[model samples]
Structures are given as C-alpha cells and as structure tokens.
Target: MRRALNIKNKLSFIDGNISKPTDSFDPLFTPWEYCNDMIIDWIQHSIGFEHRLTIAHADIATNVWTDLRERFSIQNAPRIFQLTKAISSLVQNADSVSVYYNTLKSYWDELEIYEPMPLCTCGSVKTLTDYNHRTKVMQFLMRLLRLYSGSGSSI
Candidate 1:
C-alpha cells in the first residue's frame, strides 16, 4: 500500500507530511479536503469488507492509515513457526536442483518477512546479511548431501 501510494504521489497524505488545513477560510482547505477524501476512499477500497467499519468514521487519511497499521501489524508467531518447521524438514529428494532451490528460497523469503533483520547504522547490517546468506547456503548444501548419499553418490 505504501508503494502504491508513493507511486501515485499521494504518500504525503497518510505520512503526515501534508497537514490538513483547519480553517474553512484558508485557500488550501478545499484542495486538501479533496485529496484527503480521495486517499480515504483508496484505503477503504483496498481493505476487506469486515475491516471497513473500523475506519469508516475516520476523516483524516493519516488516522485511517494508522488505525489499519495498528490493527494488522502485530507479529504472527504461529506463521513464523510453521515456516521454520517447513524449512528445517525440507529436502532435495528427487527434485531438480533449481526446483529444490526455488522452494527453499520461497520459504526463506516468507520467514524473513515474519522475522526481518533489524535496521542498523553501525555498518553491521551487511555483515549480518552475508552471514544469513551463508547459513542458508550451508543448509541447502547439507540437504543436497543427504540426497546424494542416499543415491549411492559421493559429493
């Protein structure tokens, strides 16, 4: 949603960069109101029917965006656990190398979404990312080794 709003040049509406004019006498009030209403409508249409009522009474785009974010951005532990289990149990088996790698990559991508790396300015983020990639590569190779051993082949 942020990307979509950014693409449309309306991210400022929800990001609070463009404050609404309070006075009706202000010349900016009319244009601000129009843009706010449009942004509110865009948000309303993007959400589910069950969630529409929660933001229906919100007049400000920023308020609506905040409400939705607060409601849905909680960490999902169960999903993270499921993805972790799947990644640990996955094996190359009879699948082609590309197929096995793609499946593992998808699992890793979703798991990262749930447990994203922390932002840092100490220049450790790159080191952490490199370490994570190395770990994933080791896991993939270990699983492939099992497949080769079971097939009477030496790696």
Candidate 2:
C-alpha cells in the first residue's frame, strides 16, 4: 500500500534547490528547519540516506518510540511487528526498523563526536489524532525491544 507522507517535517527546500544551513544540530521536538552542522547535512546529502548504515537507525527509531510512548502504552508481538514495519518503511525504505537504526549507527560512528548532531526527523504525527497508524507501529517497536532485551518481559 502507498504510505502516508511525512507532511510536517518535509524538507523546507522549495523548487528542489536550496543551500545548506551552517548548523547541523536539530532542535528538540521541532522539525528540521535547517542544519548548520555540515556532517549531518553531508550524511543526508553525500550518503544519500539519513542513516549511516543498518546500525544507525537507533536515533530515528528511539525518537519515534519516545514520541508515541508519551501518550499511550505500548503493546506486544506480531501485531507490533506489523506496526513497526509500516512505520519503518514510512520513515525510509528500510527492510526493518533494526536495519534502519543500524544503518544510522554506521553513519554516526564515522562522524567525529565533537559536535551535536541530529538524526533524520520525520516530523510529528501527534496532531493526526484521527489516525492510529503511528501508535500501532510504536507498540510494535516496544515489543521488539522487550523481546530482544528481555527486560520488559516477565519470566
């Protein structure tokens, strides 16, 4: 099925052309207006992906989860997988959320840590109260994490 567009954080560039901003760090809870931080832009520009590699998807995944968790409780497996897959693809063309995060890790690892860097922002769907697609995906991520880590599970 065709995915919904990330309307809120869609790149601000108009007419398909705009110069990069000087700052690369992104503001918390805000759409990425512009980045003065060269490396973040470079990753998005030169690498052709917001993620560095499969491992680097953490930044984006974590943020997405955190956003959802603020409102509702997360759910468990299978159903969660479905949700995650949808959200993951919606964010980028990743095979899975894990792959996406790892990809980002790969890119981030290559960068120097001297400066604060922001991950790819997909914008807020919190306002889209009419739909629960985002919430479903977030619940799936929480289950995947719990299953893998065994921390949220009871014996």
Candidate 3:
C-alpha cells in the first residue's frame, strides 16, 4: 500500500521525526518494508480490527472510485483514486488491474476518471457546509464495506 500512497513527507522537525544518532545503528538505509508478522498479529489482537478494506467491495469496485472522486471534488481526488486502485490491486486484483483483465480492470484506470484531482490545497470550496467531504467519503466506504461484508465487520 505504501508503494502507491505517495506519503509526500513534509519535512517535519518534531523531535522524534529523525532517529537519534546512536552508535548502535543498523545501517542508515537498507530499504525496509516494515512488514513484520508480529505487527499484523499484534494489530489483529485488537478488539475491532479486520483486513484493510479492499477497493472492490462486492462486484462494484467502480463505486469506490466514483464515491471518492465525488467526495474529494477537487483536492485528493486523484490521490484517493490511486489509493483505491492500490487497494484493489493488492486485494481484489492480486496486484494486477489492467484493462486487459476486463470488467474489474476499469477500476484500475480510475486515475484518469477526471484528469486527476488537484493535489494542491488551493482555493477550492469544501464539499459541504453540512456534511464535509472527508466524512462523507469515509461513510461511503464504510457503507460499501458493510454492504459487501454483510456483518459490519472491519475491512
């Protein structure tokens, strides 16, 4: 998932941002994935946690893309699209979401759905004065997850 998140670090200088220069270093850069079985096990031990929600809930992965696009409206639309596609690829498509795959492939090309939403937080109006965009999107995703999961289960 990190592969497509484009985390876009913003150079924060909070004391803990950078690791202390300790003599007991394990090489400055060895390209770690942070994927440890123990981490997953620990997180699973929580009371309410399930698989990271997949982009394709049921047979309609496009629903997620459309919902995210409409939610962001301007900023983050493209990012959200990419993130959803990544989730779809990682979960539904098993890492491949090309059009050649047909049907579900359309979800992969969601990045081009509307020429990519602006990443810059410019002078764009908020999606709502009653129900903000982010909240709506979260709700939409939750609904889709619930509809497919059929048990209000996480993921």
Give TM-scores for every candidate, taking all chains together and pairing residue i with residue i: 0.69, 0.16, 0.17
Indicate the TM-score of model 2.
0.16
Q: Please identify model 1 stretches exceeding 4 Å from their true place.
A: 89-107, 138-155
TM-score, candidate 1, is: 0.69
lDDT of 3 by residue, 1-155 (tens): 21222242311211124332345355632211132222223323431333334322322222333443465456556576775755454332232223323433344345445444445455453333224445433433443322344433453
Clashes of each: 0, 25, 0
From the highest TM-score down, the ranking of the candidates is 1, 3, 2
Most TM-score-accurate candidate = 1
Q: Please give the lDDT score at residue 74 for candidate 1.
A: 73
Q: What's the lDDT for candidate 3?
A: 0.36
Tens digits of lDDT, candidate 1, 46-134: 99999998888889999999888886667889888998899899998889888998999999998887789999999989999999988
Q: In model 2, where do residues sit more than 4 Å from their true spots?
A: 1-90, 113-155
RMSD of 3: 17.5
Candidate 1: give the clashing pairs.
Answer: none
- Choose 1 or 2, whichever is better by TM-score: 1
Give the better candidate number (1 or 3) by lDDT: 1
lDDT of each: 0.88, 0.37, 0.36
| Pairs in clash, predicted candidate 3 | none
Write the residue-wise lDDT of candidate 2 on 1-155 in tens digits. Answer: 00111242332222123333346553432332332132233333443253345324333332332333442233344545554455454432434657755554443333213222334355444445324434544544453533354542442
| Residues forming the 10-long window of minimal summed lDDT in candidate 2 | 1-10
RMSD of each: 4.2, 18.2, 17.5
